[model samples]
Target chain A: MSDKSTLFKFDNISVTVEGKQVVNSVSLNIKRGEVHAIMGPNGSGKSSLSNALMGHPAYNITNGQAALDGVDILGMAADERSRAGLFLAFQYPLAIPGVTVANFMRTALQAHRGKDADMADFRKLFKKKMADLSIDPTFATRYLNDGFSGGEKKRIEILQLSVLDPKMAILDETDSGLDIDALKEVSKGINEYRNNNNAVLMVTHYQRLLNYVKPDFVHVMMDGRLVTSGGPELALKLEDQGYEWVEKEFGQKAEA
Target chain B: MNIVTDSKYMIPHQSPALERGPAWLREKRRASQTEFNELPLPRRGLHLWRYTDPSGFMAIPDSADETAPSENYKLVEKLELDHLKSGNLEALVTDFGGRDIKVSRSGDDVTKGLVISSLSEAANSHAELIEKHLYSLIGGSSGKFEAMNSALWNDGIFIYVPDNVEVKKPLHLLREAGVEGSIQYPRLLVVVGKNASLTIVDEYGGGSSDFRNGQSYSNAVVEIIAEQDSRLRYISLQRQASGMQSYLTHRAQAQAGASILTIPLVFGAAISKQNFGVLLDGKGADSKMYGLLFGTSRQHLDNHTLHHHRAGMTTSDIDFKVVLRDKAMSAYTGLIRIEEDAKTCEAYQENRNLLLSDSTRAQTVPELEILNEDVSCSHGATAGPIDPMQIFQLQSRGIHEADAVRMIVSGYVQSSLKLVPEDLRERISEFVAHRLEDI
Candidate 1:
């Protein structure tokens, strides 16, 4: 899930939820300067894979390894996973009352980088990032995710991505609840970040974000497994023709 | 806890310092000393000291440690006075060991006729003002220690602002203790005239942070009087020493159309028992009392507050918060009294505590006695550990657990911090934040 070097490799990583195999024997290797997207229907284990990679307690890895470069990361805690260059943009970020966004980001940036942010420097960067995401600067002092709209929360998650600049980021349904303007803005931030040779694992149920970020590799997961893998055209085809066609080919009915 | 009053611990009032004071004060001192010897010490029978243990006062130092004076008084000298040349501060009083060091800033229009002088000097020069307010809160016979302070107190400060005069800047009273084992009674008497507004900050600190090792007990009594249509902000900053066990009482009376704010920041003392009492007597009078305490190590702190609403249409709000760690313990007991005539009054009280470690603990009790049927009053209290999810959220961002705890504690206390005036809020916030870093 994370390591010193910027390489994300998941090999036969099987995950189970309450004794049921949600992510069965998933294997993928993502390196710097690459964009990978996973598009799957509900119950296809798209979110489970992301959560397992980030070491969520609900997801148990029965076998295989998720390594960053040569270092194994399955043993690390969720926080340690974050420190080791693995960032998971949650579909629903936790609302932390009484803690401001600026304070949270300051501490996060200090941890990611080895020094505290100077007041002027932090304000400048915060203002710039907020501007780039079309977020009101006043959001800096608001409680972290408390009472934030869906679009606002998604933008804040992307805001964090732009600021922390993690070596590898997993965008889990970031584009689900956003309007067109917000989707374009979030995708723009992602595109600018991938230009720095950083990697991203985009897990989505729609082909909407791929139209903006344009993943280099597309994956169609079904029955807790990737039934098909292709280039950018795969996402367009899935958008035109729903998962019913894929289920017929894979011999498994979709969950909904 | 119970202990019989020991005759051998009686203080003799015939010292040279007593001789320097006026003869009437000397006679009063001797009489109070005798009262101290006869009054029974607080036991379970006394309700005020119920939660407090009397055994802590059983053994007393053989004699009071004699103090010369404070020579290092540069804190006021280095003040950025240029920014506040014309605001308020009717008088400036600086005393070390009850001796008047120097008084200045009284020649301007705002300071004319303002009375600021040493307690001993006022006992003779301003006899009427001193005698009127002296022991007004303690009632001259509350307890053995209070009676002893009334009789043995060497020097203190007296502040009086005349009618219609508003001191814009805050008056400063600095009480610095140098000796390790000295017994000192620091007293302050304030009377704000009608239609006058004033802010007084009384800061008590050690002469040196590297205080010598020894046991000392200090009892500080403060009384304030606010006349009609006046405003007062009183702050007590007690940062004495780790070896000191202290009792501080801040009692005030608010007249009609008066507004008063009292905030006490306690960051020092091994064991401290503090009392804040306010009496709202006039219609339309308002009072806000907030206390913030941060305890580390084995410090023991007990805080009690009293709000007496004697008139209708009065309003009062109270909040007290404490953060404890490392076996430190604190208890907060508050009382709000609303009599029959106090109809239509509004009263609110809240106490919150955060325990940073398993060994530390806090107890909060909010008691109300309301005799009026048409009044609004409520109270709430909470004491618990920080949320683990909050900690994990901060930690996931790479913050150390210790820093995360500090942040949570700081945020928990900040709810009460926002209720105070703007002047001391930032300074006290920084002090609390700094204390949390190493706790």
Candidate 2:
């Protein structure tokens, strides 16, 4: 287990879905001021891990514990987890019709501040943030994620990240369906949130994202377990050799 | 036959047609009074009144005192009648008893060949047209209130658009109900001649804010006869006091190649029932009926609609939406009937209700009766509260509890409002916003 003072720590966390274990005995640590990438194949429990840490009701944490800044998060509700400075950029954002982005953003900003955000200042800040991402001003008047294109939806998720400014963000497959240009824009948005004092956990199946947003640590996940943890070199190695080499090594470890 | 013996006031005695109307119309009202006296009141077992109680009808006071006009009632805007002919249509704004009913007209170009006047004045002038179309659509009978309206309606609007002419701007009529235990029987007879087009708006609102002792009943009947190739757009705005009860019966018949669209918005009333019927009597005719209702704080809104397709190759579409909150209840029963000989007819009915609170209630019954094998018809109904996942997503973004709900509800009702005309869309949106304020 990582030290309690660490920004985020997952100690032997196990989660179950429909009476079956999907994420088993996984331990991970996200230190303050560092970007860690978790790369895994499909159905390897990547999303389950993120959802469990965020306390999604469907992903029950059967055992172990997750904490933010030494405060336990296992029993907290999803909203409480968010209030505690944890955020998840979903792979597929839900559409909320009739809810304009401006109104939704303001309400969220107020919730994070535990008070109402002054309309004047909030407007100014929102425009600035929107400008930073090169988003059209009229987009703010549209319903949240309703009838939005795939890339546009991704941009909206990042837009929230820019406004809410949570301490640690889990980007769950944020690069799944983006082309090179959209990938570059999304990476730029994520990089804006990157600083020396805040951490980001980027969960993806490809190393293309790592190229744009460099990470200090890269971990390989297979069959719900972390098989390897290395520097940025690990991502390059996996790209060169494919996941077959890691699968073979896991088999040997189990035999031993 | 003295029909007034059962009630405090005699029906034929209070009818304006009995005194001032032509002898033929006077005799018609007398016969209608006899028929109303003979017909039994609707009982609880009738399917038409399943969700409605008969007590509201039986509790009518012996006589509605005539109210003198007061300055409290205001006309936001006056519609013009210059383009209409001198003696074809009548416009009357009636108060309870004392004050004279005000009538104002705007716009220029009054040289056209259409009659425009008050119903009371029309009774003396165009008595023949009034006698022909008045009470003709009711046929045998409807129910108690409808029969009563046919027997004793005093003030109303009579519009007749001549053939081959198109009215540019929509005609607006405002009826304001005031005082408690008062009964206002408002009637409208719209006649569109062959190849003519017209749009009319009927706006109803209460003059008083008090609901309890200020209880009032408005039994309004709107009958439209669209000749071949004619087009008519009719919109009704029903805004009553909170504790008042309102009953409305609207019927329209579309002839060959003619079209009719009716949009209704119901916002207020302790208990309200609206019966809408659209009959396609000519081949290739079409009808579109759209309605929206917002009920909150113990309001009960019941809407019944029927699309009777008696002509082949005719089409009809009906979409009704309701939003209920704070223990408000809503019931919707819609039917699309295709007659045996009405082959190749097409009909669609859809009803959707959004319940904002657990205490709120909604019941939807959409049915279709088709006897023609070559016809195409379908109906759908859905009732559910807000989606939890949707709420969670909005909450994750930091939206407040109330705003999130507003967003969900506004989205649910926006689709129905889109079918209304541009001039009335903003008014409907504002009305919905006011209904959602307390919740």
Candidate 3:
């Protein structure tokens, strides 16, 4: 590999939840700059794959390999994995009762850049990111996710994505609970972050968000396995033909 | 398994030092000494002592007199902010174990016929006024600690606001205690005159602006006389050293059309138990009591309040919240008593406690005795640990677990601390934040 080359790979990884396997042998690879969309129905293991990769306690990775640039991250804690350039925008972020969003953001960034993180710089950067994302400045003072609208939560998630920039980002179901307007705003934030050295893997139930942030590749996952892989045309095809054709033709074979 | 008989128990000796006050006060002290000697140490049989046994307090430390004033003579101003109008009636007394009693009052109210004097000097200057109200309401037949205070208390503070005169600025009392093995019986007697209003902020701690660091035993008696048609707010803050032990009694009698609000913040002391009671003595008298307690370390704190609605159409509302961490423990028992003739009264009581550690614990019991069916009364109590989900959410954002817990505790307590008047909120918040740091 060249010095400039960057890669995040999940080579034949399996995840189990409560002794029942959820994500079965899956292999995927993304270099420094690429976008991949995992489109699947409910209970297709798409969410499990992202959670297992991020070290969520509920999802246990039972087999095979998962790594960042050939360095195994399967053994790393969630925070360690994050510090090593892995980021997951949770589908349902917990509501922290007393912590303000500004403080939470500062502390998270500090964990990576040392505790004495430049406060003035953080304020300046935060001001610009919040403005760019069209978030009200007052929202920074609110407790994290406490009484926030579904749309507001997704917006904050994108705001976090922009500020806590990582080498590769896994956005799990970022479009699931958002309205059309919120989905557009979320896609706008994701669209602004694409580069050759930064990858994005989006797990979604529909292709609504795909229309805004175009993906380089689209993979169909069914019953814990990636049944078929193809280009952006596959997303358009599934959007139009409704995933039934893919389930009938390839889901069973992939399961076997 | 050794218990001292009444004949062998320690009491104030009849030395000249103890006989320096008014002859009546001196005689009262001599009599109360016998009473303290005759009474046994508080056992677990009393409902108020269920959470603790005072018999463990084996020996009352002989008063260790301060040989010299701390070179630092500057007033420890915890509430003297530029924003506070309270500096108008300022009083500073440190080295409390010393033999000096002088209240350095700003005296704007004194010029308006207000009287704030040293209780020791009351024997000469305002002997009649002090004799009329001092020790008349709270501790005559109270208990061992009350009798001890009545018998041994050497210094006194007397605050008397003249009739129909409203001293808009607060009267500040800085009660800082130091000197190891010293037993201090500090007394504060407040008599707000008819139709007059006054505010008193009483601060208790180790004289310097530091948290618990000294070892002392203090028994304090606070008697407040809310004269007819008067309004008063008594805010007491305890920031004593962890080595200090305090057993206190606070009683307020509200006369007709009078109102009183008592706010007590309990933060310090190794073992502290307060018996706070209020009497609505006349028609239309009102009492609003709110308290906050934050205990950490191995501290044991017990607080009990009694709301005696003695007259018709009188009202009382009591609310208290406590936050505990480490091995700290707190127990609160509150009661609302509406006598048969006290009809058409309203009463509400609630106690909420947040326990932050596995070993930290709290017990709250809210009780009511209503003799009139026309009275409206309600009471509730709850204790619980910090929400783990709240902790996980903060950790997921990369904050350390300890910081997260501190934030939650602060939020829980800050909401109740907000009930304090605006002028005192900043200082109260600073004190709370500083205490949270130790946890």
Candidate 4:
């Protein structure tokens, strides 16, 4: 099969965080130009799946094989994985105090484009991206995520998503803590970053974000496993019905 | 009982610099010489001497005299000269191991009543101001090393801004020590008059390159006075060469309605012990100190800061940050003391240390002494390795591990670096970056 058919795929991925398995042998494939949404209740391992895939130090992938463009990524370091065309938008983006957003982005871009990246070009691109996200120009100089509101932090995450421009982006709970207006702006950033050559896998608890950025596939996670998979309508059903029915049908009890 | 009777560390009775000054000045030097001879090396049990060994800074008996400035010192001298010619600085003073002192003014018509001359020259020209304020804050009785500097300094820098005169640009002092096995005493005395304002950058560089072959010793003393309603900003940048043992004592007093800002940036030297203190002597006086130190390799750095509120309604704040990597070690002790009569005063002190490697060691002690009932005082200290989560967040963005560490460290010092002047800030940033390059 052509690599384009499976831009990002993980098979039998089992993750144990701190010696307790959080994601159990979950398997999925996402093709280029597709957006896959993982909808689940809290503690259902949706975030863990994305974190393990991104090579978080605390998350141990016991038995899994992840690949981007047909290259194994399980053995790579977090930074190497990122350089190999994978990205993770953290649910709670850590605040790097005293580091300006412009400075952080410029350094990240340099890492991706090698040290020869023109700084003048970076400034221009950063200004345009900040404008595109409706972020105030002043934020370019503001410390990265420091003292930012919840919605502002989420917006900055998506800003990184667009600026880094990876082939496969795994966004963990990018829609949480954001008001409707902020949710709309974040979704707009995700949509803008999505194209025929890139794919997105968003782990979200709510179906509201999917309304703005339509997904080609939606998966239901229960007890650290993908219990069911379907099209966009599945997310709407899950939103309307909640995860109680999925738990009952899959015979997997949610942790108390 | 541990009196250091070594004559090598004692000042000679007929030192040329002491002979050139007035009789009163010569008497003060003689007294300092006696103090140095009688004072003992600080005991290891003492709080200030617990981490650093005082013997390392002792004068080497057969050390060489003044040598030509290193190539790096020459480069920095040219840079400061350029800054002077371009009007970025009010004046530039270069002192080579306290032997030769040169002063260059900006040439532009700047503020009036501004005096910049060698300390010996000022002892004769501006004797009234120099004699009255010099040694008032730091003197023979301050400490053993302080007394050594007081008696042995061959030449020093003296700056004075008269009442209501404001120097628009910074005055830069480039104090360079000698090469291997050399012992030099560098002194500075600054007085800012009532309602006047001045900024000074005192930078130290050039010294021995290895201790096994031979080591150099530098003992420096700085005393500052900010009169009523005046403003003073002093930045002390120490980037000496390896294999140098350096000791520095700096003290300043701010009068009523005056404010003093002190920034100490330390990066080089094999072993360094620096003490900085500010006394709020009058009511409504204010003082703020921001210090940053970055140590690498096997360097040892020990620093102390004091904010003393002696008058009612005075205020003070201190933020000292230290970053250590490799096998380097740093010990920071800060104290905020409010006197009994200093009622309704407010003081805050914080010392944060970032250890970049498991092998690096850091010690932080933040102390407060509030003798009044109607005051607010708080002190905090924290020493730990960088947050792995922050590093992971940066690394997940594709930055190499070393570059990520560098970026995080640069950010940690960004706040203090913001307080420095533009050119110096860039130079300090370069120093910090160089320290973290191999991380």
Model 1 TM: 0.80
Q: For model 3, how many clashes?
A: 2
- List model 3 lDDT by residue over A1-256, tens digit each: 3524657888788999999989889999887778899999889999999988877777889997888977899888666777787888888887765567887788778877767766668998988899988899998998878899878988898888898888788999999789988888888899887777789999998998899989988999998999999999999998999988988887664433
DockQ of each: 0.34, 0.38, 0.27, 0.84
CAPRI level of candidate 4: high
- Encode model 1's per-residue lDDT on B342-399: one tens digit a residue: 8899999988887888999787878889998999999999888876666765665666
Q: Which window of 10 residues has the lowest lDDT sum in candidate 1 chain B?
A: B77-86
lDDT tens digits, residues A1-256, model 1?
3232448898898999899889889899887778899998988999989988877767889998988755788988766777787888888787776678998898788867665545457778888999988899899998889899998999999998888888789999999889999899899988877754578999999999998998989999998998899999999999999888898898465457
Q: Model 2 chain A — which ten-residue stretch has the worst lDDT?
A: A247-256
Q: Which has the greatest TM-score?
A: 4
State each model's C-alpha RMSD to the native: 5.5, 5.8, 5.5, 2.6
Which ranges in model 4 have alpha carbons more than 4 Å from their true place? A1-4, A117-120, A254-256, B1-20, B60-64
Give the Å error, residue B164, model 1: 3.5
Which model is ahead, 1 or 4, in terms of TM-score? 4
lDDT of 4 by residue, A173-200 (tens): 9989999999989999999998889999
lDDT of 1 at B23: 70
Model 2: CAPRI class: acceptable
Worst 10 residues of 3 chain B by lDDT: B1-10
Model 4 chain B poorest ten-residue lDDT run: B1-10
